[model samples]
Target: MDSMLKADTADVPARENAAERLAALAYDDMRRVDALILERLDSHVALIPELARYLIEAGGKRVRPMITVAAANMLGHTDMAPIRLAAAVEFIHTATLLHDDVVDESGMRRGKVAANLVWGNASSVLVGDFLFARSFSLMVEAGSMKALGVLSAAASTIAEGEVRQLSAVKDIGVSVDTYMQIIDAKTAALFAAAAQVSGIVAGRPSDEEAALETYGRELGLAFQLVDDALDYGGAAAQLGKSTGDDFREGKVTLPVALSLKQAGPDEAAFWRRVIAETDQKDGDFERALDYMHEHGALNATVEQARDHAARARAALSGFPDNAWRRALGDLADFVVERAY
Candidate 1:
């Protein structure tokens, strides 16, 4: 354990509160985004507003919007474009969450009752569609075809990613590259777009835009890797759901894939029965944890996340040292650190 902690922190710089750092950097603009969200969330249909508000106001970290704002600030943007785009980014993310909760059949989100659980799956999905429409409309209102195209492409990619993931679930033979591809599309695509479009709106050069996109993609990948580890390593309260959710759902994340690769024949059969067949017995989660630890899969997953976090920081190398850059680097560190 001591050696694992040392290795995890090897290239990772210390950052006590990376999210708060990024939030403070973009606090004022985030407020504007918040106002715009409330304004745009309004609808004559009572259920639309109610369900949208419930999910939007839910205590998510709002990392995607913050990434949008931070990338804009990093590129010397001072206009309201970032603020407006930030709202659109938030809507895209919230829409995904609403839909995801229903699809995952999740009972909880951000430590509260899932919208689907409270309102029903039908309402949750429709509200998610409504938010998607609102997000696109917002991009149109922003009047940047380039930004609109970036986000629009991201939306489609995210859907495709989701579809790809649906196929991979319960298929224990999924490779690490396939797992990374799934996360890149489903999660990192938005992060990349949210950051890249800010550069576009700020009129940053193409290289800089690409750099921001890389930064966001690596950060998103690192974030998801950490989340995968946390499912087995973290307590239920920390996850806002039961631990081993990926295992129970028959989802094949990195830890599962890695452990499966290293499993003996007896262990492999156990995984096939539980994951491929979805026949979980009592203490299966505990045994899964034991396998993850025994094979060093969880620690390996965290180490890989730290590597992506480092890549995220390296992507910011061309940018000047400033609050935005610093906070973004810290945020990368915090993503990997969260696994601990």
Candidate 2:
């Protein structure tokens, strides 16, 4: 379990310039806010700090936290509360990543060894729990019960989504509906909570809050969709894991699910045998990839991701034109275009 966000080749260009964009969203002192996050994340337990630092220092794009800060700035709040909220969102996200890596048995993240790989699963899981609890305490400090409610619900949804994915493993019949449900819970719920909480903290009207929630939900869907696509299309070094790792794990992503349905008899038969069999050989990945390409599922999946990205950008129309809002729009475009 690594708390780090995987940086795709598609994300690098946007990230390289993220500092400049972030600077445009002014606060009283953004650096002080960052320092607050670092200080608050500290723990008395030595091991907690060690494992947590591995994740914090692993260097994520910190995009979710950025969204929280940006949304608050757009709504005219530049207080410490927004910074605390942003840090809470990052903690929640990082905790989920730690748990996910343990569940997924991910070996590498961000071009480095995964926490689970370096520290072992037992320590990683416990450290993840500590971070999750720390996030809740930080949320309480924000003094908005509405924000707490939204975030707590999101955490529950994320867990459920992970469990749903576990149940769907090796099940070739996992429909798009099931996949959508998983992504909505596992990915979009957190994003929605992050944006919605930002609005709540800023005392935004309900309608505006709803709009931000929608924006986050759609953006998250687009982000995860592109992530699924990259699992098939990216290089091992670039992806920070082996290509076709999803298929190798018998995890049915969007591309494979669509491919299984559209495949002709021979291809479909291959999918059936490979998916149903618990003991998948090394060759299964190669064959599954070939099937995905032949059936045009890979391209179709990328198109679906792009469609979501477009929808995400469109959702920002509710916000007034500002540098932060415009940057948000550009970030949406960055999410999809980076897949190239």
Candidate 3:
């Protein structure tokens, strides 16, 4: 049963250590990005830095910023602009997490207590705003109006996506298309901007810039799709949050949306009672998982993620055949592999 939820990537050579390879390749640049993140987190307001650091130091993979650094390195960029943009990317992501935890009323984030739980929602939200402001400052320092424009738009798009998702909560009627659109904005926009901004700062060709954007967008989609599937079938240790957080929150994510479509009268009533009505009871989550598995919803979601990951790798084909390109490609596969 667990095997059914794993991503099918047998044709591709196994790269279970793809993230480690990419990290090793980009270690020095990542160190600089990390330093920049901590330095900019400073503030006289005391709680600002305290709260920001709480979330920032909470052991995220820094995947978004790493894309910025790796894309810049792949383009042979030799300036500090990539480092600045990468830090800016991390800030944007951290800011979003702070706000998301508050909205979701999340208890845990990255295996630790959510910042909002310790600092209160008001403090978490205000500090998130501070980080967003700081991100723009870094973008300005990076000195490319074009890059700034791209990232600024991404930030706006992310806000819109979150609001859209919030509005759709507990909506069993949400289509898979609607779910994709929501994630594209909420999760994938930053990834696209993070990668595209590098090409902008490096003054790469427009076509290459487009490719990077596509790669990041597709990868982000795959990443979120896998996350949706994992919420039902993955270990809490692997997810960094409880396995059924989405179900408990009544989030109409990809799996729920897919399963709802395939449900018959009895299962449909069960979904309505548990999800739409929020009358969840003991074993409701297990029943939901059973419905998803019975309908092959989890497997279907993972297959869709694999398709997106393949497209993400294909988007990198125009780039130079270097270690950076291969690492990015492998990272796409790794995104889907997380479902296992």
Identify the leading candidate in terms of lDDT: 3
Clashes of each: 0, 2, 0
Q: Write the per-residue lDDT of candidate 1 for residues 282-326, one digit (tens) a residue.
A: 998888888887888888888898998999899999998998888
* lDDT (C-alpha) at residue 247 in model 1: 83
- Each prediction's Cα RMSD? 4.3, 4.4, 4.1
lDDT of each: 0.87, 0.78, 0.88
Task: Pick out the ten consecutive residues of candidate 3 with the lowest summed lDDT.
Answer: 1-10
Put down candidate 3 lDDT per residue, 116-220, tens digits, no spaces: 999899999999999999999999999999999999999999999999999999888889999999999999999999999999999998999999999999999
TM-scores of all predicted structures = 0.93, 0.89, 0.93
Q: What lDDT does candidate 3 reach at residue 167? A: 90
**Which regions of candidate 1 are displaced past 4 Å?**
1-16, 234-241
- Native-vs-model 3 lDDT? 0.88
**Backbone clash pairs in model 3 (N, Cα, C under 3 Å; residues 3+ apart or in different chains), count:** 0
